[model samples]
Target: MMITNNPPVLNDTAILNIARDVLDIESTALSELKAQLDENFVHAVRTILSCKGRLVVSGMGKSGHIARKIAATFASTGTPSFFVHPGEASHGDLGMITEDDVMLALSNSGKSDELMAILPFLKRYGTRLIAMTGDSTSPMAKLADVHLLVKVNKEACPMNLAPTASTTAALALGDALAVALLKLHGFNEEDFARSHPGGALGKRLLTYVRDVMRTGDEIPSVVLGSSLTTALLEISRKRMGMTAVVDETQKVLGILTDGDVRRLFEKDVDVRTLVIDDAMHRAPHTISPDALAVSAVQLLDTHHINQVLVTDEQGVLLGALNVHDLFAAKVM
Candidate 1:
């Protein structure tokens, strides 16, 4: 018998059929998990919520990969959690687990030898165990304070030997638990933003108008009685492409932009003779100093304007910002 290195040829239809079969199997498994949800899930959620210390998620093999992701989700959402390998737990790593902590163990068969090794220690330390397993009758499940059944009809693998559908089921169940805890704890977007400070979500939630807007002398402005030429000079000097027309008290009366100047020129009107108020838009778009920078982006995009004035409730001009500023701040 000779073994060749040639690869097997597969048509697009055949490839698509195989992909669909895998998806169908996983989808069915998820449906089964959904139908199996009962008071046991509620008990698991209650156990996690009641825990004073962080959640310690442990697993081995493919289940360990899912465990790490699930721990990440829990940590980012609201519940503080970290992953621990059961094999490593037998070593000094078990010191990471505390009495107040709750253990979420994942195993398809609920009988992983490595996991079983830590069961006695977990019990002796009074650490609550929440088991996610396929077999509710298995030793881990029987010993668990709360059992989350992630049983699947079969693996998506052709040989039904590798962990496929079971892992998917575990991941989805973990997500479900995390989301439920998030809702119960009233973990809003701001809380989530705090945990994820370096992402786009943080930029949107944490970056405020005051943080990015130009203040004091940086703001381009001209008095209400100032001439169009004076406003134009301010706009050019500040390079904001616009200037605020304000009263003596520094209250925003109107806004004059390069576009307004262009319109004045298009009408063949001599801008030098016109006052700033004559060419200014009285109903200028304004944002609060406390508003999110993302809101400013929306205002500029919605009004199709390049820049907007930042003002207080009484219409006092405090700062100014342009689309370029938002882009520089990564809020755009």
Candidate 2:
């Protein structure tokens, strides 16, 4: 009988050790990248900032994946940018680029034929070229307006043929560039939130008190000197768990809550005999119509109350809202 050769099987310890080694190698490569930040990086950032048009990122293979992520980071951080495949650039996609635009190219070997083919077209169109590569002496790097060094000492693969450490270094460098530009442009959290309005952070940042508060006839309120019975009826009719006590001019005087009613009952006093001004809590927490809805939610939580009055600068009641309103608006 003839027996076939079998592949070697790795034990648990060997598998774990290989994984640890890969992580260690990638970590060291990142450390090296931090040290490689120099004047060339500054020049690249300056070129991108000075460009009048959008930034166009292009790469091949693994570099293409990293390039797409970099483009997204830049766009979300207030920089206008998009990615183009090098292969497609040679086709009709090159028309997407213009003379005013800047091109950011990624190539682990610094010698991707697809990218090299479009280099001349970019140059002829007067588009600035920023190359991220491992080989500073390669033709692509030498031809670039600015070269960002992303070289790695070794690959994580045992054969040293895969683009592992080099790709990580390139991705880190791209992130660095994006963050630097973000700061340079004074991009703040609000700007980022605006770009991502569908996200939770965006909702919290962009939602204002006026956007969620119950306005017009929806607001539950009683005029000053109104009987506690009248106030209670208004609260029950509005179903907001409370009612605002306002003056003749609609200026907020105080707020009466369910807790206040409970306390009043505990006192064994006839609530019908008291006026709303006597039972309502003075100096109640109030929010401005221009304030963020998140602020209203925080006020409700901090004061341990279920409702708050929305007022204008003149202290006039503009609207009212409860914890439920905030929940319905997804502000909580």
Candidate 3:
């Protein structure tokens, strides 16, 4: 490849037009690809579901990148799949494929020499092969147990040499397969969360109230019989904007919040004459420490409150959480 030190003059209008044309071409390619789905697709899904071992995806060149992404999608969605380079597999990585496993090979032209070299070995090994390609009559397609035709009308590249629309169509088809398998396998958000525990979705779905709540002395709380002034002091010291009012046995009796104090002042009541029992809300929204953090967030949203108490089955305050706590946990 030769680097051009002197490039052509910039044409902003032409660049934007070319961008639109590229999208239009890829969009049409996907539409045509959708119309081509058939029973072979069904057979492919069933084949994967019946697979007792991992799915091994293999490809060459640009299709290899698409294969890697498809493999990742399948793995994250509970299919237990991974990508293996056909070139590498021909050397010794083919050992990763077992008789119980299924192999999905990607090759747009269906004639990549590297992928072609491994098909015979997979056949003798009894590993099922599913080929995604553009030509049904190609060797890779003919050798596959299930052939998924991803043939596009034309490449998005004006020269029709670079992979553009074909790759997009292949990627979309991979998503379709992963989603279909996900539905059939009964994989849910929690399952996805387990596979992606470091991601935002995992944090939202997996984190519990106990995981993010402030406990022990760190929690802002006051006992029953405490004066309104005492409760306010606890709230200010803990900086949670609220204090749990608990009985002698630590059972929740009520809750006192800054917003409640504001309401009292709004009515022009004498603050000095107020007691904790008189000022506190008799019933406060509470959640279990074991509940999902997202549930706590929703509880606060539903009640239009910024803070919530975490309680045990007997209504004993175990911990506390505010909007900031949820934000820190990234559950919001």
TM-score per prediction, in order, is: 0.96, 0.89, 0.92
For model 2, residues 157-239, the per-residue Cα lDDT tens digits are 98999889888889999999999999999999889989999988899889999999999999999998999999989988999
Which pairs, if any, clash in model 1?
none
Candidate 1 runs further than 4 Å off = 1-7
Runs in model 2 with CA error above 4 Å? Answer: 1-22
1-332, model 3: which lDDT tens digit per residue?
A: 99869866769998999899999999999999999999999999999999999999988999999999999999999999999999999899988899999999999999999999998889988999999999999999999999999999899998999999999999999999999999999999899999999999999999999999999998888888788888878889999999999988888999999999899889998877767889888899999999999999999999999999999999998999999999999999
Q: What are the C-alpha RMSDs, in order, of all predicted structures?
A: 1.9, 3.4, 2.1
The clash count of every prediction, one per candidate, is 0, 0, 0
Candidate 2: give its CA RMSD in angstroms. 3.4
Q: Which stretches of candidate 3 lie over 4 Å from their true place?
A: 3-10, 223-225, 263-268
